[model samples]
Target: MTNRNIKAIKWFINTQLLGKWYNVAYATFKVTSKCNLKCTFCNPAYYSGTLEEGSTERLKKVIDNLRDSSVVVLSFEGGEPTTRPDILDLLGYAHDGSFYVMLTTNGYRLGDPSFLSKISERIDFLHYSIDEYHWNLKALDNLCKFREFGLKVNVQTVVTRYNINTLEDKVKKVRECGYKILLMPAVDYPDSKVKLEPDKEQFYQVLSYLKGKYGSTLNNSWGFIRALKGEFPKRLTSYAITIYPNGDLPYPDDINGEVIGNLSQNKLGELLNSYRAKELRRKMMENSARYEYLHLQTASFNSIKDLAEYAREMGKWAFTGKA
Candidate 1:
């Protein structure tokens, strides 16, 4: 590749393309598990999930293995990221000015203008969740108030059968609230009892409208659309890793997939290799119903193919209306 092309490729690898690469493009920093609200749909298990965090020193060791790539973004989430005592210090600790720092929050805290002012200084993008779990479409105002400093704010609305029909109107109103919006498919969470999966036709019809307005910025990608359409060819592995609060590593924490070694005691690269070498990877790869579901939501794999498959399954949909 030419110098310009190489730079362009690396940029994509760090951002949009990181999902496909084994390298860490996004780190969901679970600052702490203490949340301000307990949504009915959120599992108590995830909230009670491990509470350990890698210190700055250990975090740097994780970064060292990143090879020639820089971690493009580190997302701070909860219980409530703002609840963590080291919130500001952790923000300052990781601010190298190269990567973007973002947070996915519930907006109960952002209504305080004083806190908004402080957070706007370090966080690049602020994402607020609105869904059946969050149970309201009205928190957009709190996010919009931060516009004065040019802080990027985005909306994340998870779609379910209960709310799918109303998404269009909510989308327009949220757009007027002044931040970009993201339409997400509700994952198969236990508390939901899997009742929230949108009807396939209604879901796609919603996507038809979303794609019309937001283009590629609609959060869910075309591949995600294809998956919702049941075009998934075979099970896939995830390139992403989730190290819980207490430092235990779970293969696909979102779906309660499988457990791998903990980050505090074992390294990710070595653990992946050894786990697959034990014939466990083949068991999941060959197709067992239980493993297939686990693989879909959170599968542990030994190869890049696993990550690619997982990315296709646990696909992400995020967008900014930065104009």
Candidate 2:
């Protein structure tokens, strides 16, 4: 079996059998908060509260901690991860570790053959951000080119009132490129004057239409899509985790922006066992039944294939926009 499969199996075992819900299965490490483009919807383009880039040594230690726990996938993100001179070094380190390494980029630097040559082999997949705000529709044409390098590609589109009506065209482009797209609602930071978040009913209608017409190409699980519309309960602590550029762990992630502790200084395992972490986990368990994806009835997994089957079923429901 592949290392990725082994790690995923182990993570599933830990979370289901041992009750390690706080032990993250997926993590987004903001390598740096600095980005090259000034996208109107993204925070990195304007937010200045990010800490200085952590040294390569510091990030490696963080990766070690996550791998030793139950993290299966480690996604490297940034204002633009390609901007960092040591990004290849970081990707190489994670690739050598137990976790499957993925990179999220704006695709600005990916057009260069030499640049793609150096980093393509180090990552398992590329999460290309494409939308109207980024104004990089040209990148969509280059999706198949990255696949030629033997790398999986997934597009992340941030949905907003401005772009909701036009998503069908973008979905067609993704289908023509032979890639999957993960659609997400745009967040309106409390401090921002512009409110691009779509209307509640409109958001549901758009998501449902995309799911029904192009479910095969959409990447988000059905539970997640429904949870966004308040149809399903969201258990943030039960699933993914995000580590900020400064090594700080934010509760419910960036929404509240409350830092629990720095991973650079404290062990994540120990922190999760602490009072605050325990309280959050306790809350997660109490409300776990509300999350459809959990399938609390039979939490045990016989094999990785079983888990995949379950996810596939949930994904079908998500595509149908079924409650």
Candidate 3:
């Protein structure tokens, strides 16, 4: 990574925290759970039967509520966001030029040049999911096809036991392919036996190595990277109300606060945050204990004077806060 990008990233992280944007910056909107491929690691029941989704008018109203929210970056995912009949209309709705619209695609349809031509006008970035469970390692070739359309292509590879050992090589290979690589370390499945989640040390080792080595290609913030590497901060599974085509998500899907709100009547913010602050106090505590050590040395960590004092003495290269 160049010195300029590093400075820019640090600046971005500071701006995000100072502005409270990254804390609530991005949201994952499930347009439709109807995916064409059935990968093993995927939960098919999440999006089965007749496709269900919010109409353009309804979704627009949902976006309206987010005005109080500075989350200008929106990631459209699904069972395959493109499957929605109104995909273009939905993209157009989000195309106010103020928001960064990203799509997490499996790349099956992207192989067709026509598809890129259609959506290239709308999306800012195209996030391609290529991992073991999705079984689309070869999708990189298809991804390269879209670059010509000028779609900023980023590949998300969820590193798992079956593939973690080879991730570095994969990153190298992905870089050679001319696309940014965002590494999503695999998470544990609550019901699974083998527990695909890697050991904490191993996870940190990989993240730390990457942060120091390919800091540029890793799309996640440096403070976040350091937080994971230095202390294995208890990760707060992101807060996004991922509604399926049926407009339902399993309770406790990922975060402390989330809900499948009926935007038709309910205020999206109130419905999601209706739970009292006390409800999340425990999770916040857990996160602090797990991750507070990583950001000790950064300017932002010290700048968090309102939050704490000792967070200053912490250490160099600590991942205590910020990203």
Candidate 4:
């Protein structure tokens, strides 16, 4: 079996059969918070360049920590990950590690052919963030250009109340380019005054319709589609975890969970098994219905059917390079 397949099987056994729910299936590593765009819907601390970035060596240490943990997929995120000077080195290091590496970016730096060429081989998947809020709608017109770099591009668009009607156009464009697009609802951060969360029912209807028309081209699984309407079966805190720029884990997640420990300072296995982490997980479970982290919500598999569907989708994308 492939190394990736082994990791996936181990994660499934640990989290599913063994009842070790905290075993993570995915890890979003916030490499840096230095982003060029100032999307109002985004949190400033993550994108305003306010958070100090770790050195290449320090970042590698955290990657090592995750390698020892049950993380199957390691996604590099940012204010904009490209903003970091040593991003290529970090990507290469993570790419060589055990996890399936993915890079999430705003497509700002991807305009450079040199940059794309360097990173294309380093990451297993490229998550291009584009939407009306980013003011880079024109980037969608050139989705085909990325295919030359030999990178599987997945366009991630934020669905909002204002732009819900325009989703079909974006999906149609993505379909024409033979690429997949992941649609996530616009979440209202705790500190943000502007409420951008879409009407739940309308959101579900639009996603369901798109899923029916496009199938796997629209990366929302049946379980995740139901989650759009707030029908989550249980909290998926252990399914995925988000790491800060400084290697600090925001416990179960970044949304409602607290920082239990730093991966750089301590091993991820130890921290996750700590009393503080256990207590926080219990506390978050009491209010599971209120968490708004779309990624975490999607990762929270509602049923075996949903989990199987998602696994098949990811397997195809990872092995065959098709959505």
Best by lDDT: 4
Each candidate: what lDDT? 0.56, 0.69, 0.55, 0.82
Better of 1 and 2 by lDDT: 2
Candidate 3 deviant stretches above 4 angstroms: 1-23, 45-52, 229-260, 267-278, 281-323
Worst 10 residues of 4 by lDDT: 293-302
Instruction: Look at candidate 4 and give me any clashing residue pairs.
Output: none
Which candidate tops TM-score? Answer: 4
Candidate 1 residue lDDT tens string, 156-196? 78777788877767666555645556676555554565466
Question: How high is the lDDT of residue 239 in model 1?
Answer: 35
Residue 135 CA displacement from its true place in model 1, Å:
4.2
Q: RMSD of model 1, in Å? A: 6.3
By TM-score, is 2 or 3 better? 2
Error of 3 at 84 (Å): 1.3
How close is every model to the real structure, measured as TM-score? 0.72, 0.83, 0.72, 0.95
How far off is model 2, as Cα RMSD?
5.6
lDDT assessment of candidate 2 = 0.69
Q: Which runs in model 4 stand beyond 4 Å of their true positions?
A: 234-238, 294-299
**Ranking of all predicted structures according to lDDT, beginning with the best and ending with the worst:** 4, 2, 1, 3
